[model samples]
Target chain A: DQQVKQNSPSLSVQEGRISILNCDYTNSMFDYFLWYKKYPAEGPTFLISISSIKDKNEDGRFTVFLNKSAKHLSLHIVPSQPGDSAVYFCAAQLKYNFNKFYFGSGTKLNVKP
Target chain B: DVKVTQSSRYLVKRTGEKVFLECVQDMDHENMFWYRQDPGLGLRLIYFSYDVKMKEKGDIPEGYSVSREKKERFSLILESASTNQTSMYLCASSPGGGFNEKLFFGSGTQLSVL
Candidate 1:
């Protein structure tokens, strides 16, 4: 079973537009959520994360919104740039400690210039 | 900054042969993990080691084993290569075992088994 699911396999957006990617989880115990970005041949890299205690976390042009009641999270990039094109994965952390992470299939985002 | 380095970016192996994939980290992370990435399956963990010589099987450890002799090194072993094992193998390291710790990944090793 997929504890975390990104439903959307791919998404495309125009430059300078808002690009939103969504993720959902079934496990309520997952308190910490993280986002990673991967290029075609590169490994994933940390993007942003949020704790269950907070509803939203923002860094620069990226913002992650957490809906605990809905068990859903979304990443928003304002003014999406062509360079932002990559596969985005959402992962969840069960315990506050230890590196047990569950990942989603990933959403491929394409930004058109 | 944490840096994870995989020994190979691309490899080709013959069926029934043995394969060893190596990973090294410069951050002295205590936790290291191995995962395979395939289309539709995403990234599934193969094995992980919290400390030297300690290993735990992850979701997909059927055809793989792991060895950790030093704090900075982790190795994934494929006892008998098979066509099904051809995929991108990724190695990651975290400062600690806590899920809160950010993971640093190597470039990845793409293996092709014939």
Candidate 2:
């Protein structure tokens, strides 16, 4: 069973526009949600994260919002750039098991200039 | 900065061959993980270790085994390679303080089995 799911396999957006990538999870025990960005021939790198206690967290142009009641979260990038084109993965970490994380099938984001 | 290094960037192995993929971390992290990335499948954990000589099976550990003799190094072994096992293997490490620490990943090794 996939604990985390990214329904859209791909997303395309124009540069200088807002881009939103959605993710859903089935488990309520997850206390922390994170996003990772990966480029071709490279491993994923951490982007931003939000704790369950907070509904939203922002880091410069990258912001993450969590909705516990719906078991869903979304990452919003303001003024998307061409360099932001890559695969974005949503991950959830169990409250007790900090060492283990569940990841969703990534959504490939293409920013067209 | 924490650096996780996979021994090889690309490897090609034939079926029935015994394969070993090596990973080393410079941060002396207590937790290490091995995950495989496949198309539309995301990153699935194969195995993880919390300490030296200790390991735990992840969601997909059927055809794979892991060894962590030291805190800085983790190895993934394929007893018998198969075509189905071909994919990108990634190694990651994180500190072990029970905190929500982000995982530092290696560049990944693309293993192709013929």
Candidate 3:
């Protein structure tokens, strides 16, 4: 069973627009959510994260929103740039597992300039 | 910046060959992991080590084995390489096995089994 799921396989957005990537988890025990970005032949890099205690966390142009009630989290990239065009993965971890991440299928975001 | 290094960026192995992928961390982290990423399937965990000389199987441990000889190094071994084993392998390390701890990842190794 997939604990974390990213239903959208791909998304296209115009530059300078808002790009939102969504992720859902089934296990209620998962209290930490993270986002990672990956390019071709490269390993994933940390983007942003949100704890279950808070509803939202923002860093520069990136914001992560966690809705504990729905077991859902979303990553918002404002004023999206061409450089942001890549595969984005939503990962989750239970309170017990720590940095052990459970990843989703990932969403390929294409920003049209 | 914490650096996680994988021994190779690319590797080629023949069927039935024993292949070893090595990962090392310089941050004195207590946790290390190995994952394989495939197209459309995302990243799947192969194994993880929480301490020196201790290892645990992750979601997908079949046909694979892991070793943590030292605190900074984690190794993944493929007993027999197959075409299905061709994928990008990633290694990561964290200071502790906490949910909020950030993982430092290596550049990844692309292993091709023919």
Candidate 4:
């Protein structure tokens, strides 16, 4: 069973516009959520993360929001740049079991220049 | 900075042949992981190790096995190569098994089983 799901397989947005990627999860035991950005033929790099205690976390142009009640989270990039185009993956981790993580299928984001 | 390195960028093997994919980390991380990434399927964990000589099966460990003889290296083995095992393999490592620690990943090894 897929505990984490990214319903949208792809998204396209113009540069300097806001790009929103959504993810949903069915497991309430997950207490920490993270987003990673991956380019072609490269390993995924950590973007930003939010703890269950906090509803929102922001880092420069990247921001992550979590809604515990709905088991939903989103990664938003403001003024998206062409360099930001890549596959975005959302992952969840259990507080007690820190080593194991569950990842979503991923959403390919294309920022048009 | 933590660096996880996969021995090869690409590899090819024939059916019934034994294959080994090696991964090494510069940081003395206590936890190491092997994941397979496929188109549209995202990343699936094959195996993970918490410490030297210790390993745990992840969600899809059916055709794979792993070893961690040293603190800095982890190896994934395919006893008998099968076409279904063709995919991109990624290795990751994280500092102590602490809560909220992020993972550092290798570039990945694209393996093809013919």
Best by lDDT: 2
Write the residue-wise lDDT of candidate 2 on B1-114 in tens digits. Answer: 999999999999999999999999999899999999999999999999999999999999999999999899999999999999999999999998785788989999999999
Task: List ranges where model 2 is wrong by over 4 Å.
Answer: none
lDDT of 3 by residue, A1-113 (tens): 87899999999999999999999999999878889999887778999998899999999999999998898999999999999999999988888867568899899999999
Tell me how each candidate scores on DockQ against the true complex: 0.71, 0.84, 0.70, 0.82
Tens digits of per-residue lDDT, candidate 4, A1-113, equal 88999999999999999999999999999999999999988889999999999999999999999999999999999989999999999999987899999999999999999
What lDDT does candidate 2 reach at residue A103?
97
Clash pairs detected, candidate 1: A97-B98, A98-B97, A98-B98, A98-B99, A99-B97
Candidate 1 reaches a DockQ of 0.71
Q: Model 2 lDDT vs. the true structure?
A: 0.97
TM-scores for the candidates: 0.98, 0.99, 0.97, 0.99
Alpha-carbon shift of residue A60 in model 1 (angstroms):
0.5
Score candidate 3 by TM-score against the native.
0.97
lDDT of 1: 0.93
Residue B114 accuracy (lDDT) in model 1: 97
| Backbone clash tally (model 2) | 0
Pairs that collide, model 3: A98-B98, A98-B99
- Candidate 1 regions with alpha-carbon error over 4 angstroms: B97-99
Query: Candidates ranked by TM-score, best first?
Result: 2, 4, 1, 3
**Model 4 score (lDDT):** 0.95
Q: List the residue pairs that clash in candidate 2.
A: none
